[model samples]
Target: MLYSQYLYQDDKPFKTTIRNYNASDFNQLIDIQKECFPPPFPSDLWWTKDQLANHVHIFPDGAICAEVEGELAGSITTLIADNHGEDHTWEEVTDNGSIGTHDPNGNVLYVVDISVRHKYRKTGMGKLLMQSLYHLVVHLQLEAVLGGSRMPGYEKVKNQMSPQKYFEGIITGEHNDPVVSFLMKAGRSPIKLLPNYLDDPESDDFGVLMEWKNPFLEKRKHFF
Candidate 1:
């Protein structure tokens, strides 16, 4: 329920709050998924009221939203997973978007979804949400945060190279995935490449498992 710092528009400053989204946000949250993920991505995959209700009732801290000038701008949902960072499919991990696999005392924070409205893209809303997540990890003393991110641009190069190679290109700076690359800039790194992770035709059903280590935990163990 703690608020993240304020964000400004490129031309003028506007108040943006990053906090736990409630049941009232359910309608807007569904709308954001459509705005962020257009056709070709299954509409059925969008969150339902029952699923969002589980998120709020089960682990409210992990259900985060970004609001600008009292308007819903974006959202990111997570759960403390039981998978132990395995190379699991998105459905298996997130329990079909209900986050039914949530384990409050678990060490890993598993991000199931993140979306920013098209009008709010490139406005730093996504990054601010991530920054709030980092704080959540530290506050809860979790070991790490993880997510299976789609390689949307892979559709173009699926014929040219393997998904692994496409991922390598992204890491090596030779290629950039509009979505995954931005996540890289937010302090996460791709650790594993998963196949058939989701039914994302835009990604050829490919996903890259990304991770952000809890620096607070790291500092407690290392000499650095």
Candidate 2:
């Protein structure tokens, strides 16, 4: 389905609330994650009484959830690190193998994943979830945020197309994917494409690393 432009707007009147993810919320959060993504994380990874305990002990304040009228609408998990000098830490986590290390001032906020439920998608919940994370970055005095996107793979038909061309078409909205459109509107631009990043030999879907700088910080103003 083509992404609805309205989903990216913040002028809605939804009663969005931000809260720390707790033990009781784990199951609901995982359920929402499964409903939103193609290859969702295993339920064992997120839904358990011990999950919140682990998160709190390891990285307090890294997981956050959004609610609309008491329903679990979306969630984001972040890891803050020292100024890594670059804006693709999330990609690095997926590629280079380090997961929890950060820069000196904790200036880099790597958004591991952000997802919104399918029914609530086009009402700006995704952008709201993202903006909430931005506020978290500012609150923590972070420098930048980064994440990854899946670029569509090439097709070998009667007329084959190159992988690069397939990805370009996807980003340009030729395929009508809303996630790409939303990313572009959120001030995220692609940094690099990691070929075979997903390890699917037949799939040309490369990883597109994207980043967004804190606008308030860029203006030499304090986030607080």
Candidate topping lDDT: 1
- Superposed Cα deviation of residue 105, candidate 2 (Å): 4.1
Error of 1 at 167 (Å): 0.5
Estimate TM-scores for all models: 0.94, 0.70
lDDT of 1 by residue, 116-193 (tens): 988777778889888888889899998787889999988888899988899999999988898899999999988878
Instruction: Write one digit per residue (lDDT tens) for candidate 2, span 87-134.
Output: 343345522312335343566676666778887777767776677667
Error of 1 at 104 (Å): 1.4
Misplaced by over 4 Å in model 2 are: 1-13, 38-53, 82-99, 102-105, 152-160, 170-175, 199-205, 218-224
Q: Model 1: what TM-score?
A: 0.94
Per-model tally of clashing residue pairs? 0, 6
Error of 1 at 43 (Å): 0.9
